[model samples]
Target: MNKLDLKVLDKQEDFFIINGKEFNIGFTNAEKERSFNRNTEEGIKELNSLKEEFGANEVIYLKQIHSDKILNYIENGKSIKDEEADAIITKEKGIIIGVFTADCVPIILVDEEKKVAAAIHSGWRGTYESITFKTIEKMKKEFSINVKNLKAYIGPHIRKCCYEVSEELKLKFIEKKTEIKKEDLFCGRNLNLEVCILDDLKKAGIQDENINSIDLCTYCSEDVKLHSYRKSQGSYGRMFSFIILR
Candidate 1:
């Protein structure tokens, strides 16, 4: 039920890049009120616009849970119900995998040769749980994706500037061997969850160069665009980081 405060990154446009493909990335500002309304026809309309921008039939969406589970599309006409997983993957061509996030990091994975892609919503819980690692592991095991050949983009989310945590959380990161310093733990009382996650990804084998981080701080700038839960008192609109195999 927690969501992000909708604030746009004026300098940051919605774009993604395939590992080796020339096809450009497309993004949606789900923070728009119309995009978040579950019962409103306008919500569906907004999705339709996304379809036009990124091909409607090719998109794949996941029901995100804070857990590390990952699902693959069967390429059938089944209802895309909310599944209790943090990530979704597919080998089906033209299917754009979608991951929702506010303050949590939204990650998109793509392997050009295999024509496979994945979307992961990595929250603090997921970071501690290593959901991103698990998703990469699944991609390697199920799709034969070579970790070295894979590429990932860390989308907009809460950064260390405003993401404060407790001593317990900081200890948790240390216990996990995160490379962040104790001083970088924002509020001086807690840990920087986002940095912890980035470190975890490196530990999990995501090459430093292969990773692209937007480096946006959601809580500091709440009035511009997009949504931030920490700044907006539990808003629901979510920005999407999605990718399709073309």
Candidate 2:
């Protein structure tokens, strides 16, 4: 497949259409009126509207504890409330899986042949735990998906330009994977998260050509509409990244 093509669905929503296919992958913006907060009545209404707008038969939104736990939607079969996981996978059509992120990386994986999809929330902690690799493994075991046939999309996040980390944390990452080079972690005190994610994907049998990044940095983008915890000093709304097998 070609690189994922991004199109603005409206002022508050953006959907990514995979080249030559009808993949329903998208991420919401910081639209005040259509917030997916789920904490207030208005927020709940907006979320319901989102579901209707996208034509999702079922939506699995997780609590997201920053762990490597992967939830299988088919096995769980609805009733996804209070589920603590950073990644969610499903093979059922119309079952949209979603994860919220502000500065953390939001990744969507799709196997068109098998009609299997996954949504992952990979923060620094989740990345260190190899959530992406774990999710891929779970998908393979449950849905018999081949990594070669999977298309991975890394969405907007706090890129290396603004994702500074402590030396101790950087050392921890290197210690976890000895093969990780210094250049991969150093971008002037910032970590090149996408590089690390790409490395893990490539190691897990995903082809270099099949992986793509949106390349938009949430923290550095001039567009104030994009949410970024780092840019807003931890006072930003979460953007919902979702995918459905249509």
lDDT, candidates in the order shown: 0.65, 0.77
Clashes of each: 16, 0
Candidate 1 displacement at residue 67 in angstroms: 1.3
Over 1-246, each residue of candidate 2 has an lDDT whose tens digit, in order, gives: 234334433233344333326467777766452456555586556566656877877667788888999888774455664788899888877766788888899989999988888999999999988899888988888899988899898888888889889989888877886667878767667887877787778778898888877767788776535688777777636777888777
Kindly provide the TM-score of model 2 when superposed on the true structure, using C-alpha atoms.
Answer: 0.89
Candidate 2, number of clashes:
0
> CA shift at 89, candidate 2, in angstroms?
0.5
RMSD for each model, in Å, please?
5.2, 2.7
- Model 1 scores a C-alpha lDDT of 0.65
TM-score of each candidate? Answer: 0.81, 0.89
Worst 10-residue lDDT window for candidate 2 reads 1-10
- Model 1 regions lying over 4 Å from their true place: 1-24, 30-41, 77-79, 178-187, 222-224
Instruction: Indicate the residue-level lDDT of 61 in model 2.
Output: 79
